[model samples]
Target: MSGTTRSGIPLADVYTAADVTAEPAPPGTAPYTRGISPGGYNDRMWVMGQYGGFGSAAETNARFKRLLDQGQTGFSVALDLPTQLGLDSDDPRALGEVGRVGVPIDSLADFETLFDGIPLSQVKQIRTTANSIGPLWVALVTAFAEKRGTDPNDIAIFIQNDVLKEYVARGTQIFPPEAGLRMAADVVEHTAAHLPNWTPMALSSYHIRESGADAAQEVSMTLSNTVAYLDEVVRRGVDIDQFADKLFMFLSAGMDLLEEVAKFRAARTAWSRLLESRYHAGADARALQIFSYTAGSSLTAQSPHTNIVRVTIEALAAVLGGVQTLNTSSYDEALGTPTLESVTLALRTQQVLAEETSLAKVADPLGGSYVVESLTGQILARVEADMDVIAEHGGALRCIESGWFAERLSQQAYEDQQNVESGARRVLGVNCFIDDSTIEVPAFSVDPSAEEQQRKRIAQTRADRDQSEVDVALDEVRRAARHGENCIGSITAAVRVYATVGEIYGVLREVHGPYTAHTGLG
Candidate 1:
């Protein structure tokens, strides 16, 4: 049999032990390339996280219960762009966007509405796509703790707080990269001290891939950002072990199953080595490097039903890749956010894998394969080369500031699109197979008046809350920002005083200034 590389490099007929890196240590030990857990899924299966979004808080909460009832182990919450960017639903820029893509959150009141019946203490873990609104995210968590009658120390949160990538790729950033990094570090330090069970910042490569990065580029960029965060936190005098263990990873599992598995394995190995060499973090800090995977940007829009088959394959790759958590994307995501049915199908995909397939019964089943081991080594070597480039460009922050990162990804994306359009890349049912007769596609519709209703809600929230209290909270937060105090505490104080998400963000906007995309650097 013959094999090929992801970038079309020809694979040799065989590989020896020397071809692969020397086994640094045993599985579940330091430098965990073999695997993070020796028992693997035999001990505990990966946390099966499903992404759910809907137009209304009531609708989203109902679907969340339905998914949990169907055996989902973790919950991933998707907020609308305005909410994620810390805009009140009533803002003019937010007019046409509220609840169009994800759930609309206007205030602490809307947050309360979203998780009304669900008890936070009983849930395993919760993930959010929050970046620019990092302070608001902290506030919301604090409010949840108050309502649930549990200490903020007990609740678990995995916020996608990678602000540099948000500005450079996703277009959801509200502040400059410097201020954003400061907020992420604040979350890291705060969660380490208060919420030991929580994962505060999830350095996300999933969106970088969605922004059109290839496997090697995605791995390199994400790991570089991770190292940047580590450097910042250590420079701020936070101990490496104190916050490194709290740093989780959010990655993507694309159509390349073997490459995906190899990527995860290599990522953990590289991360472990980086920590050991750079910071001298202990085994416990390096061993439990939590990773979560989402379905990638490879799936299509035409034959939407085929995306189920696509997502199942991607989920399997994540499982085999030893992900600690996984989020299966909806089949109908291309058109818009997922409907309840599509979301449930996504959740059930993981359930079937967890319960029916013996896939979870073994760990690192591909650990000894000649092809997989060889590919893992190749991927790591490429990632290291990419890292050298990032370092030469003065790290990820400088790369983004220089626009080199975006230019490279844009070229890759254009090539990928060209490949698909020219039939060089065959996406089944899209560029090939051309089956118009056998398709029974589901009709997806976002709530027609969701934007209007969201605006009214935001207006009513502004009218209802005491303006004097809001002023006091914002002033205190601004003072904290100037003094270089932990912004998490200031955010919590503001939210306790009933400050809206928009108001809290407005304070940061005044202090930190918004990010402007660089055009000339490319």
Candidate 2:
């Protein structure tokens, strides 16, 4: 009997060498189907990263220190919606939202408080999930480093500067599509020349998957978005090799165990081929690095404890698929912001998977399995076809601007919701296994006074800073944005002079204009 994968690819019951038409490469070879590193985890284990940020900067700093002390190798930041939208905590547009979902960072002072006693130089990687305001985060980090007498070049920063994905999936976009692309590419060009150790752009399929794209759509759309970014940067006079190696991709580990693994393996293979054949990227550039977070959408509010098991399984899939970095969603994430106990449990999940399991000893442990290999090949082919469709629509940027991509994802999201409602897709606690148990998961809540405190701080900062110098710096940034010049340096200068995130973004907002999603397409 034949079956179908979650991505709607046909699957065979059994397979032989006949199923594998292409030459099988080793773990470290180009078009890395097996794995990227020759030694794999034997040389170094994947970074155990935890995604966190909430309330005030001091509170988030304490959480970061606790996670680091508990053996988290890397840390990821989640900025509040107000910060992500380039509004100050005190802005009328930001009422009731400051420090609610994530940390509220209004100025360099907030960044300082966020990092506090943590030595950023020792952190393996600092991943910030900021899209439209990504350059501001970069500037804050650079200024913070300089204040502490640390060279920004020594820090390994990964910014989710994939603004195109923001337009299609996440709705935190600020500027219009064309201008957003320019800002995203500007970060790549600036970081290539300045921060040598930083990975400027993390092409995120995670949010796309969470927004309801299937495995195939997630991988294909991400790669197509990467193509848009690569073209933009190359047009700015940067070599393919210069910035390609610094690029990274983020995928989502969902409930389909084998299919999730296959999706990742196929992504590595597809990325390698695309870079080599199209961009002429060298070996280092072709060896794509992936970071994955277990799917937040997969967690169920009903029987929230079951989410722990779901996260473990997804994290295992990421490890088996050879992810370079992994973050497991907390069990209580479906309820609200993760409580301290829940986040600790999430970190322990990674620790146990890395320390107690023998799965990491070998690279691509399931590389030769009949089912896995067959699925991998099928996903690669399907993703390529999806890419062709995207190209036919005049590429990723055009599709995004015209709302084609948004319409497709919205339809898929509607269908998935319908499936769950009709009992076509079985979610254990949500749809199938009815339970009378009370929901007892402890969820984190932000202090109501956090907004007031942030407002007072920003007001004090404005009173203390040299108003003349701040005006000059803001003007330089405005000039750079208006004149089509690289704005990273000017933005950094503004950040150093105590300019607020809202101030810098306000300048750009004036230049590029705001973006509102077109609702007519859906």
Candidate 3:
């Protein structure tokens, strides 16, 4: 290779054991650079998850059944902008946005409808893209389990509760950073004590990567954010060993085969070392649960069929990288929400890898390669250097508050785009391949009635619910938010009364106020 990798790491012509800087180790050992599981996919294939959800709850529920019927090992739900912001479908702010991006959940009734006919224990795990309303989502899940007469301990939930990323990457943050961190930690504390099978949060680098962070920046920023969360939770009396194992990671699997695999190994090395050094967490706590989604940013609009090949490469990278779970992107995602055909094909892509190919039979098949091992050490050094900058700037929280973090990412994003536009980088079908004809593919769209139906459903729920009970429940939530207490219990009480998602968050808004974005630190 003559040029640099996507993250700007130089590629060497030839490599040997001497080129590798990091010490070699076997699978399932300390630092975990080679791999996490000794048996790897032979012990069990990485959990195959397909992420999807859009339109009304009933519509989303039917889609969930489709994935379940297809033998999806895990289910991942993508909530709409309104629900992610904790707004009801009827709210004026949600008028044009209800069910636009993903499923709209306004009340507990909508939640039940979202998973109707699908049992809580149907999949190995169920995950959601809930940040600002993460605790409320967990509360709804547990309440649903109770209503279905299932033991809460029997189910597993992996929520994307890392709100700090929202502050740095973009918007949709409901509370200020400090308050948001506190609430995110509350979910961890509550889940550790109550739902042992659940993953409180997935420190997410996926969005950061999608927002234009290179591989090294992605891992560094994510780890810095992880440190901030650990400090806050431990201050609240959460024992590190007890809840550290509950930590999960959500990362992007990009098309750089060597770099992606190297990034994965280096991330594990950093995480395992951090836990051992900081809190004296044992092996179990250092072992991370990683859920990966193939990079949607790599999909192209022209010659959409090419995406099938693109996603396959990314998915293979994630597998070879030793991720515990994977979600392959649909080929038609660049055009619109994926159609049933495309979604099924995406699921089949993973099935073919596991069953047909012998890819899953070995543990770290590329572990001994000179190029991969050298790249792994290089990526880790870059990550640590950047992490040192974060620490020097007074940590993740200060960087965000001062807008240094946001500004740095913006500059990096601009530089990355400039490289592509200037022909320094080539994107197949986009820049290099001159395809004049448009290739059409079937695309899925949310139903127009989904919005109106969601509104009426929430209105009906509000009327049918006992007013006095809901009032009491919401008051307690207000009290918890005001008193700096863990809001999970109060949120759960409110969820049981069929309280609207907007209602609970509305009480929180009254206490914490709406969040406004910070301008860059100059």
Best by lDDT: 2
> What lDDT tens digits, residue by residue, belong to model 3 across residues 7-45?
889887888888876566888887888777788898878
Q: Name the lDDT value of residue 449 in candidate 3.
A: 83
TM-score on alpha carbons, each prediction: 0.95, 0.98, 0.98
Question: What is the C-alpha lDDT profile of model 2 across 302-366, one tens digit per residue?
Answer: 99999999999999999999999999999999888999889889989988988898887888889
For candidate 1, the lDDT comes to 0.79
RMSD of each: 1.9, 1.2, 1.2
lDDT (CA) for every model shown?
A: 0.79, 0.90, 0.88
Where does the lowest 10-residue lDDT sum fall in candidate 3? 513-522
lDDT of 1 at 219: 76
